[model samples]
Target: MSLDAADGTESADRLGWAWPDLPPGELGAPSPMFAVRHAEAPLAPLTLPSGDRIRAIARYEDIRTVMAHSATSRNLRYEGAPRVTKGLSIEDDPASMLNMDSPEHTRLRRILSGTFTPRQIEGWRPRVREIAGELVDTVAAASGPVDLVEAFAFPLPSLVICELMGVPAADQSRFRHWTELFLSTGDASAEDRVSAALDFAGYAAELIATHRERPGDDLIDVLVQARDDDDRLTEDELVALVFGLILAGHETTASQITRGALRLLSHPERWAALVDDPGLTPAVVEEILRYDGPGGYGMLRRMTERVELSGGVVEAGEAVFLLLPAGNMDPDVFPEPESFEVTRFDGTGDRAHGPHLSFGHGPHYCLGANLARMELQVAFETLATRLPSLHLAAPATTVPWIGEALIHRPVSVPVSV
Candidate 1:
């Protein structure tokens, strides 16, 4: 459907553009508008939720080029750069890595790199499996329909992140609440956003101080030492880095766990296949990442210099949105992209499958990708092994979705075990 057609009766009165609708009955499928734009206007001008105009890059090659190019920066603080919304640009925050580019981004990322290495994340697998198993046991023992998101998806990652960051057990729920409010897209009021930001910053400062006085064997302590002993991180940067880690460490994985479970339950055969052969868990995890990863779009990139793309010439200082979901569904890359076959990435499919861009590409690829994979792998394995009879309590269509957010996820997944 055309943009106007998709907008339906609300076309004339809308304040900002609506995101392309997901294809009917195919959760996470690229909206028809995405395909149309890829063919017609690969770099189509679009209005942001902030009502700012940007060239939305829809094609896989164009999107990849923008992400991989050093000239296209994530730093929104540059004078006259375009923003996703009107408020405090995360770029303006001294503590936000989301807004940093180049040497600075590399510096902060280096500090945390050792913590999230594949070996480090792999070493945490036993702990992750134990956590997943306990949550699954709770669901298995429940008497009636339980919300999988509340019971399993949210807490497993929340606890794991808390452990990694050395957050006190009692403070986890508060951190989760702060994260939800802080990460709000257009839905949260400016006052709410400000309050969340202040609250989280204050809490992080206190936590960092405590770690300084009595360092623990956690990521936070490692950072605190880097700041105190090496003087590598400034006070503001330290606080911001820790805050960013807390927000990202759990929120994305929680969304994936909830969505992945819903995807499996929606396709009983797929769920059964995984239950029958647990060895397929890894392939299933990759397919889940490709089919319906939580990331709805790429982080905003502003062109530092004029660049040529298939769409057209983008002048310096213009912002571009890399539409990752659309690239994930590109038929040129994956055969029958809309269908969610668990084995599609296992070399048995008709077409050779390439890596999905859900975690992003290039220098700023997600730092938590390895940890996220481990959490998801354990989540599905535990579900299939312990609660083999689990099924959706409500129709998949009836599950409510959070609107106007960068990450697309169901509010809850009601299930019976």
Candidate 2:
């Protein structure tokens, strides 16, 4: 009953076997199959039950090489590829820069880079702090238990992006729903997910139209101009880009905030340290990105050409499923990789920042990294300082986690403020 790959490797431990049927309540554990395979054969031919052959890269350096290699590409939306979702065009149609190879990817990335400049992100500090202050104030008012995911984590990035993209308050709820639909790779029916994606695209089209009619000073307005002036992107490209921004921008931050908070809350000593020295907020955020990040395994990426990887050779048009969390926790690269260390990257005097594969590396490095960093710093500082008594209401293990999800979001993080 186990699937076989081109190399005739057969095992009951295919990556697909780990999902939609993962052992209930086993959240945040590395895929034992992947870990073992990587240890024995860092690159193994994995035969998915769907009859697709994928080269699974698991080691830290190898994974980073594959992600940053010119031969590999994020563009997986062509015909005949093994798709992550059946009805969603994200795997079938041409994607934005995130899913494109260079030249095209670079061109699109450049237009938006202006807004996300380091200086610009730094400028957003006070606003982000203000946002955090407001959310914490509201949580304090509730007095009763509150789910950090819904109350703070979700809204912080959602509203930040809303402000960035100029989305109005009245329309933000709808935006939130569309975002959840597009990003949901767990627990959503294919049909439901597809319908939501269509609705999401439809929503983008409306926003594009509105921006075209009455341009604002937000990123969308800038993108609309890029489409019209520089001819950098087409209308479809513009819509897809904006859609990608909203989808990728908010959910990832939400996961980090919720998961990162939970990690700190669970480790009281670390929590206390952060409270004492707020400067550790940035390093703590980096550690969170490395540890227990939301995006785990299951996202399918295609090989741009035939190449030898680790011990296995993959051909052009073939698909690969990389387990990033596995790579992040690789002992070969990170000493005591499993242990959460805020100062591991921050060396004394020199402060050598260790490479965290969290934001990814090379060309595909996360676009919103600066924004995510700022949010996390403000979030942790505010939460630790404001709600010193904040503690998890439910047992950490009792919280639901989607091991197979494209993004890991805690079902509920009830906390007392």
Candidate 3:
């Protein structure tokens, strides 16, 4: 299955992408998109629904090229950029560090740097271990079966983030609801989304006020103190930034943990192998991230100027979507890329994992990668040790994935204690 090139030659028409109107969750499944773009043509021009043009960087090298390119700007304020969401003006505003270009991005990102450093994230390891252990115990005490997503995956990251942000444990339920509404793409009620954002913002504002009077050692307190000490970020920016971090940090990590567990548990051999050798846990974590990480692709970045990619020219402002899963399966890079190898990169052949773009690449790589890794490493080690015989209670294909959600997740992974 190949697409005919515009040049009317078979050689030029090397790729054929059978991308269709499937729901978001289903898109990650083995689709023609992978078979065509990754197997046939690594670089291909794709016409999106809105008649806008963008190129899909499917091959590992191509994906890295796009992510590492300077011409690409994460700023959404560009003329023809993908709309992240309709609710917030930040979707198109170049204010968020994730949406800004060089100098401004550098300035805003620096504000977040001192706090989210590797040292700070690594310091949270003990707490992450404690949270993972506590959650596992809670589930163990609960009798027969447990929905891992609800019981463990969802809360561990959420609680850790709340603690870090100085958000109270009691407020997480409402915070979780609002974060869901913001990231949802299905038929979510307009009122639900807007109302949640307003309430969440008001709550953040109140939290900031409280922190100002009584400063603490949490990230939120740090931000507020920074705001006071240096005229760096405004009150609104602080609110938005914290809100963004809370949502981004928790949601993606939760989803990945849930999905990764299911991915391994469904294959008992993999689960057993990890249990047999706990050291393989880290490699397994990386493989899971590469295999089924949350985030459809990295953030939507726009072309700052006219640029040529894959023998096609993307005019300035056009947005490019780098599908990470496709890149992970590229044959040129990873031999038999689809197969899950626990020790995938331990002195293998000439090919390495080739930088799974799951955490993304370049300066905008996930700030919480270390924290996420710590949480995941602890998660697998503990779960595998405790529930050695743990297997998916339900069939793999029957497991439901969260729909139209930014993070890929199983709705409820049922497991017997």
- Give the number of the best model, judged by TM-score: 1
Q: Report the candidate with higher TM-score, 1 versus 3.
A: 1
Clashing pairs in 1: none
Model 3 per-residue lDDT tens digits across residues 1-417: 564422222321221211232123232343334646665655565543223345666767666766778888776664546554444434543445676677776666787777667688788888888888898888888778789988888899989988988988888788888887766644344457667777777888888999898888888988887688888877767887777788777888888888788878888889989989887888888878777766554346677777766535667867777777777767777676667788885421123345676777777777777777777887888888877777777778778665454454667898876
Q: Which pairs of residues collide in candidate 2?
A: none
lDDT for model 2, please.
Answer: 0.71
- Please identify which of the two predictions, 2 or 3, would achieve the higher TM-score against the true structure: 2
| Candidate 1 regions with alpha-carbon error over 4 angstroms | 7-29, 78-80, 347-353
TM-score of 2: 0.88
Which of candidates 2 and 3 reaches a greater lDDT? 2
User: Residue by residue across 154-246, what tens digits does model 2's lDDT show?
Assistant: 888888988899776566678677666655554345567777788877888888889999988898899999989788798888988888888
How well does each candidate superpose onto the true structure, as a TM-score?
A: 0.92, 0.88, 0.87
Best by lDDT: 1
Residue 160, model 3: lDDT of 91
lDDT of 1 by residue, 82-162 (tens): 766556546578467777788888998999999999899999999999998988889988999999989999999989999
For candidate 3, the per-residue lDDT at 128 reads: 85
